[model samples]
Target: AIALSSIAWQSGMLIGPAMAGPLYAIRPDLPYIVSACLYALAGLAMLTVGPVPRTIMDRGKGPIAQIIDGMAYVGQNKLVLGVITLDLFAVFLAGSTALLPVFARDILKVGEQGLSLLASSPAAGAALVAFVFSFRPIRTNVGNKMLVSVLLFGLVTVIFGFSRILVVSMACLFVAGAADMFSVYVRQSLIQLNTPDDKRGRVSAVSLLTVSASNELGDAFSGMLAWLIGPVAAVVAGGGGAILITALWSRLFPQIGAARSFDPAEEEA
Candidate 1:
């Protein structure tokens, strides 16, 4: 199931840009129009699906109480907390993708077509890694490997920040994407496998919150930093911060480093 999910996700990543770049080249507004139509189709398809199952809901408790309980549960679970914290900080600091327009127009001197390539490079790398992992998922030293992947992600972001050549920048982003894919897969698997069945929905809510904060908040952070500092300096500093956070998280969440596998029985024993 996990492998299939990963493949589906990567397939979208692979196809979206492959289609978007040419569509964007033909017309700047075309991509948005197509995206809106696709979204409408998706919504219609979703309407055809069955209603939400009662098993996924917590009917016994008020919404506010349920939210509080979920937060408390996450706070108490060291593994989940560690994974979430690592993701939050790493993504927050390594969000150079938010500044791609600056890089494309100013740094690389590539026009819209180049911007499309730069945007797609990371997804291409991620898709490749996801495709490989779908067949041979990581089964040992999951936590340590995830941490290492984050470190690599940060390092590549730093390289991408300093790069003047378009190809070099693309290569750096590609490497960063691969590293990020490893971290994401491991973190998600750990969260899903470790959380209790009764609290799964709430835990998923928490995960969604973290993902939103990391992506949206991180974009805001990148923009603000780019305004305060130069874009190159901002990206370099963010990458450096990510690397430092990885070191700090390694100490603060030793349990994550010690975790051997995503399998519940293996984790328990």
Candidate 2:
């Protein structure tokens, strides 16, 4: 995970500025195409790298049975369901990033350079903090940390929504990114620790799908909402939604509240 994150972070840092310089000159939407290409290449690399073992793969079940069993296991596990739902909700509502170019240009009047920063600021902050976490892993109440991080992320989104100044908005986004990094670590670690060895592949695939669905769905929602109610209002609404989601999820998932460490023993496997 660290290796993949590093590769993506470095690749984006290198390509983002250069792409923004030229593409935003022609069309602000051009960066999305470039991003799509980069992601496509990354996906290709992963495919070529071959299959990875899932939690359930060690059980010796047939391939189709393995998939079905994973689904059944996930359905039976409230903790897993809660985490997955939380991930989907948070990512779906908070991911307004794809529309940042429009926000920078039309809303904040910051132009393309600002757009580039807005687009990449969260990842930049995440990459920085992730680097720190890689060297010295956090040992604390993981669940509370995730909740706090996600809450802060929502608050930062609200701050960005209200700010007219380019620097202020960017700073808010940077803070959001930092918070999101903590959330990512907590969630991913939780998934790994809780899942049975044989079911890892299917669960991971489902998680990946959830991520793609949330991001794309969030982008569509943001774009439509912005068109309907205006950009600032849309962002503010999304922030409000994120806060509500955190509150509801906190009440619903007591296991998440019990998270003490990143140890597999902390959760049932």
Candidate 3:
């Protein structure tokens, strides 16, 4: 279900830019108006979802206590810790998306239309991969596949960082997006399968928090690195950092590598 939802999200991403480009050319405000309408429709659609049964917290466990418990649980679970931290540092370092404008304007010299294309390429790639996954889900060696996806993400980012040609940069971005989607699919699966139902919400909260932090902090990291060095250099170095983090995390958390699948019926890793 999560994977399918992601595919839907990616489909929206795939279509958004195509609509925006024409609307942007017609009137910049037109794109904004369309975005607002879409968001409203999304909110309305969300209301259709029925509530599911949830685990209730004990009265004795205060908010702070629950939070502390979540922290402890996350800290102790090797597979959980591995996937979460791997997501954090890999994304935190590969902040290359922060420089799309720089690449489009200064480097590629493709102007607004080119920028639109560049922005859409990754979504196109992600949407394609997700579409494939819908029909053929990955059912083996899920952990190592996650690591490999992140590694590929880093490698593509590095290529994008160095690419001067518009086509090459777009190609790299496309692959990067595909790689990121693959990793995300695996991460979400393992995290959920590994967590108990009572602990799922708590673990999910922590995972969500980590992902949110990575995106915000990642942008800041990219911007700062660009200021220190050139944008290309910053992106390139960040990609390298992501690659290094992947290798380091694999050794540190052997449990992740040993994880074979996400089958709920399975008794062991």
Candidate 4:
């Protein structure tokens, strides 16, 4: 499994840029076609991966126990709930991603290449950061790092909302992506490291639900805000809300600051 996962990631990392060149040469829609192809390739690679775990009988805990433990853990852990809430807010305000196509056409008045750059720059920043993190090992003061990252993310969002220049907007989006990636890494690491083995699957399921909820709910929120006020105002307000939430979270969860390690056994079940 590990070897296959490594191979798949390395293959994507090596081959992903080739798609970008062709995508730029053709049309804006070609990127999606390229992405679909990459996804198909990834699925094929997964076939060579290790055996899949049995969900019904082989696992240590029954489905009911896992579900109950997961729910109970979530209900008791204020820190995890807090992280999830902040993630929700950040995702909600940052639905600016969905509006990038509109901005490329109407706001920046850029070409197909410009639109592709706008879409891909954020991912590039995140990919670079992920590469760095793999080597350096983010070990100390994770909570502090997370808070700083999210704050920067919100600030960059506001900056992107206000910028008229294409370069400036792209820069802001790049920074926002970098910040968001760091924050997400820390949050996911904390959650997974803190979750009990018996409840990992259920906890992961809840995280999945949170992701879908945030994306769909964020779309609705951004759309309504844009309609009632304006796109700029909606984006600015969302960024401001993100900053405020981060501040409040830091004040309320001070212990998270010194949390150097995550141990699920330490949690009260």
Residue-level lDDT of model 2, residues 14-51, one tens digit each, is 35764675786888688789889979998998888767
- TM-score of candidate 4 versus the correct structure, residues matched by position: 0.82
- Screening candidate 4 with a backbone cut-off below 3 angstroms (N, C-alpha, C), the clashing residue pairs are none
Q: Which window of ten consecutive residues has the lowest lDDT sum in model 2?
A: 52-61
User: Which residue runs of candidate 4 sit more than 4 Å off their true CA positions?
Assistant: 1-36, 52-65, 262-269
Residue-level lDDT tens digits of model 3 in 1-269: 77688888888877887577778889979989989998999999999999987786666888899888887899999889999999999999997887888888999888778887888888888887888888898998888999999999999999999999999999998998899888888888888888887788889899989999998999999999999999999999999999999999999999888888887466352
TM-score of 2: 0.84
lDDT of 4 at 29: 76
* lDDT for each residue of candidate 1 in 116-167, tens digit (9 for 90 to 100): 7888888878878888887888899999999999999999999999999999
Q: lDDT for model 1, please.
A: 0.88
Off by over 4 Å in 1: 51-58
Model 2 / residue 147 / CA error / Å: 0.7
**Count of clashing residue pairs in every prediction:** 0, 9, 0, 0
Off by over 4 Å in 2: 1-18, 22-64, 266-269
TM-score of predicted model 3? 0.94
lDDT tens readout by residue for model 4, 1-269: 22233334433543454356556677867877878987899799989999887444336777787677787887677667667667877778766776676677777877555666677667666766666666664867787888889899888888888888999998988788778777767777777777666566777677768877887888788888878987777778888888988888888776556455545444332
